[model samples]
Target: MATLLHLDSSAFHEPSVSREVTAIFRKEWEDRHPGGTVIYRDLAKEPLPHLTADGIVSALAPVDSHTPEQAAAAALRSELADELERADAVLIGTPMYNFTIPSTLKAWLDQVIIVGRTAGEGGSVAGKPTTVVAARGGGYGPGTPRESFEFVTTYLEKVLTGMLSLDVDFIIPELTLAKSQPQMAPLIDAAEASRAQAEQDAVQKAKTLAERFAA
Candidate 1:
């Protein structure tokens, strides 16, 4: 059966666009594969520890040579990597926090990426399909005033593709705060349209991947 590693890192669980979009994708995928396995992690609820020196350095030495701290770090890294390796696909819900991804999501990336293992050439998850739902409070695409400040998609694209060798796609729903912020009432309609498109895209992507993997 196909397996998906799904993660959500939105701090505001009550009204989170990224989380909703990812859920749409998951539902479509589950509909396609009733027996599929999904490994879910709500990063905000149970955040992983930030990557530490012990974790990085542990990759350099023999497993037996690791100190107690390094041993623990290495074990955690292995567990995360194992999950990624077992997954047939990956999905991440990351709301833009200060123009970038949430710290919890960053922590998950840090722990899951290990040089010459989960990352680098011949990485365990190389070319694996990954879908990222990047929700932003405001418009940040090209031609926008804050386009230069947009880092969520750019940064994740680099890390997930350049470092981890994953085949990545993104579903962006911008201006998520337009409805909540009175001053941006003009953009509420646009926001709604963008969100609708994102959900549609999510369903399409999910079904396509599910069919491909199930074949």
Candidate 2:
């Protein structure tokens, strides 16, 4: 049976566009593979520590030379890497914060992006299929006023595709603030349309990917 690694970093459990869309994908995936395994990680509830100097040194140092703290840090990194290595596919729910990914998601990336493990030659997760549901509160697509400020999808694409060599696909729900912020009231219609389209895309993508991976 296929195994999926699902990560959600949204702080809010309800009314989160990223979580909503990712749920659609996950539902479709589960429907396709009823007995398949899903390893879910809620980063907001159990956030990972940011990489420190000691953690960095421990990751590069020989296992035998690791101090007690270094060994602990190395172990955590190994666990995160193992999750990615064992998964047949990955799904991540990322809500844009300050125009980029949440710090919790960044911390997870730091833990998993190990040299020779997930980066350069012999990378464990290299070429793994990954789907990212990126939700942004404001419009930041091409030609938008804040286009340059959009860093969430761009950054994830760079790391998952460029760095880890994962086959990454993105499902973005834009202008999510339109429903809650008074200033964005006029854009609510467009935002709803975007969200609806994203949900549909997520279903199709999930089904297709599940079949491909299960085969």
Candidate 3:
């Protein structure tokens, strides 16, 4: 049976666009693979520690030389990497915070992006299909005034593709705050349309991935 590693980092619960879209993808995935396993991590609820200097040193040092604290940090990193290594696919729900991913998500990435374990020639999750649902509160697509401010998807793409060598796909829902913010009221229609399209694409992508991995 296939195993999917699912990560959600949205602080907001029901109202979060990223979470909503990711739910669609998860539903489709579960429907396709009823017997498959899903390793779910809600980063917002259980935040990971940011990489500290000690943790970095421990990751590079030999296991036998690790201090108590270093060993604990190394263990956390290993656990995170092991989840990715065992998964056949990955799904991430990330809402843009100040034009980038939340600190919770970033912390998780720091824990998992180990050198030989997940980044180099022997990367465990290399070439695995990874889908990222990136939700932005404002419009930052190409030609938009804030286009250059969009860093969430770009940063994730670079790390997941450039570093880990994963086959990454992005599903973006823009202007998610349109309905909630008075200043964005006029853009609500466009936001809804974008959300609908993202949901549809996520479902289709899930089906395609399920079939590919099932085969």
Candidate 4:
């Protein structure tokens, strides 16, 4: 049985465009795999703490901890690692805030990307595949006005691949703000449609890889 860890970072709930698209993808995934289980984590609702200097030191410390803070930090690292260890796949719903992911989500990333857990001193994500669903308010793909504003995708791929050693699949919904403006719905709709198409394509790719691995 494949276990999927579903993470949502958008502060917006029902109306969050990113979550909307991710929800669709989640439904499709569940339908395709009837017995698959999904573990949902909402970063916006339950924000994770950023890595503190003390936390770093504690994480590097041996399990023999006398201080309460050190013990807590060590426990936190282990818990986060266990989450990744238990999951067969990960799905992230991200809203582009300030041309990047939400701060809360970043906090969670800090916790999970621990040096001996998700990766070692050499670096590798010894877990499973991670799929990201990114939502942007404006056009920011290959050749749009905001094409240069692709820092989010570039940074995400590099960090997830370089630091975590995880296979990544990205699906971006561009021009998400278009529908809110009467003059831009058509353009946004087109972008959204493309995003939806990409989701299906990515899912199919993942399913193929999964089946091949099972075989």
Q: Whose lDDT is greatest here? A: 1
Against the true structure, candidate 2 reaches a TM-score of: 0.97
Q: How many residue pairs clash per model? A: 0, 0, 0, 3
- Per-residue lDDT tens digits for candidate 1, residues 123-205, read 88999999999999999999999999999999999999999999999999989999899999999999999999999999999
* Cα lDDT of model 3 by residue, 18-94, tens digit: 99999999999999899999999999999999998777988899999999999999999999999999999999999
Output the number of the TM-score-best candidate.
1
Task: Give RMSD to native, each candidate.
Answer: 0.8, 1.0, 1.0, 2.5
Candidate 1: segments with Cα more than 4 A from true spot: none
Candidate 3: deviation at residue 166, Å?
1.1
TM-score of each: 0.98, 0.97, 0.97, 0.87
lDDT of each: 0.94, 0.92, 0.93, 0.76
lDDT of 2 by residue, 102-177 (tens): 9999999988888877887767788899999999999999999999999998999998887788999999889899
RMSD of 1: 0.8
lDDT of 2: 0.92
- Candidate 2's displacement at residue 91, Å, is 0.4
Model 2 residue pairs with clashes: none
